[model samples]
Target: MTTKISSVGLLSPGDMGHSVGKVLVHNGMPVHTCLAGRSERSAQLASAAGLTVNASFEELVQQVDLFLSIVPPARATGVAQQIADAVKTTGTTLIYLDCNAISPETTREVGRIVEASGVTFIDGGIIGAPPKVDGAVPRIYVSGPDADQATILNNHGLDVRPIGDVIGHASGVKMCYAALTKGLTALGTELMVAAEAMGLTGSLREEFELSQSAMLEHLEKSVPGMPPKAYRWVGEMEEIAKTFDDVGLTPKMLLGAADMYTLVGQTPLANETPETRTRGKTLQDVVEILNEALPKGK
Candidate 1:
């Protein structure tokens, strides 16, 4: 029989993490997180989501039956190690779910880390936006031998779908899905900035409207919203590149996308949070800003 999940622990609640916490809270699950040494914004988000802040990882691991790691891709491994250490120190045995946008290789490495402490590790990938109160709900696809253990979340307002019993299946799905969605965004940003640099922004916009209206519309919507999230996406792009390279495909395209996100991260606009970013900025505005922020020549 599967163990009953009574409470949940979320690691470092950021935008997406906080929203997921809120949904679990509203569904009658007590959500907790450790805000020790976290940024003020993270604390604020956790408080807003009704998550109880534990003093440290040790305290957190002891209290919750399930733990979710939803950090950026670059930090996923480190976070797993930390949690594993906490689980060891506290003698706590909880289900660990890694929901970051990392490659299958990275996911397996994390699995080894968490599973080493004798905790059940569930590989998970979140697709779509954060869970909204009334809008579309994001799906958390899980895989691994214990993938069915995550189905408890389905009773608590999340759409937890168990895809397979293989550890990397969920992350592989995520890598391929993001490769298309974010890869296209990178392609659009590059051409828009190039157009701006060549002083042909207006002409390019006209041509796009004449022949590539749908693609143009997608760029207009995606690029303007990218700056705030670009920093995290840099690591995600790199992970996607690694995913492609592992399968014998050239990783150059997504590596270039990583570079594009890194450049965007250097822009002043990248400092804004999702809640505080300017709402009226157009794609042209984003392109011009990126063009102006270009370092040195070329």
Candidate 2:
């Protein structure tokens, strides 16, 4: 049976969520969200994305056919419980998609929460950047019994890929992928900061330029772009750590990465949003800022 999705509900329109809502609206799907108690920036992003703001959570649950939860990793389970409660209170049915960065264990917990309320739960993991007008479109990998139902979004400005009929497959994919991309970013940040602290940054850059040019280039871009997003990545790294531990692998590396992000989150640079983070344009600038904030030697 095909699910007729006339309207879609997005939780809070942050960086990725707003762009997704924009794409859905452009593709002629009516996207709606409840901005009650959300940040001012969220309201601005939602308005810019052309999403209708529901007056209440009950109204939001009652109106949409599908609900996409794209929040921080720490908030994933909480948001799922909120949706389930809303569904129970309003007696409304909607397909619930969990698209946060989380482990398979967390995904199963979310599935159980939503499914217990009689809502169809789809495990989803989004890879790549948010949908842009002229840039690369992200792929939303979905799994579980009704994964095929998400394919309806393929041509609607989303690249929905149904990977399997298991609840955790999609989140597992995200865990492994982020374990590399973000994992490496954390590693690079640590070494670069260490080098800056020891005054070996110049020699390190010279060596990287001669033998590790590609990696140097990657670090230059990634390290500088990390501070604003580091706070969010802290929870994601912890989730990755959990993912690794579940597979009997050492989780220490990713846990260290979580600590690295935690340190970055303490820096003043982490307070800036992507739109307002204009201070660190170069790798050295970011490293210098972070190095200065480091605890002094006793």
Reference-based TM-score of each model: 0.97, 0.98
Runs in model 2 lying further than 4 Å from the true structure: none
Per-candidate count of clashing residue pairs (backbone under 3 Å): 0, 0
Runs in model 1 deviating more than 4 A are 296-298
Q: lDDT for each of the candidates?
A: 0.91, 0.92
Lowest summed lDDT window (length 10), candidate 1: 273-282
Clashes of 2: 0
Clashes in model 1: which pairs? none
Superposed by TM-score, candidate 2 places the C-alpha of residue 292 at a distance from the truth, in angstroms, of: 0.6
Instruction: Give the range where candidate 2 is weakest over 10 consecutive residues by summed lDDT.
Output: 273-282
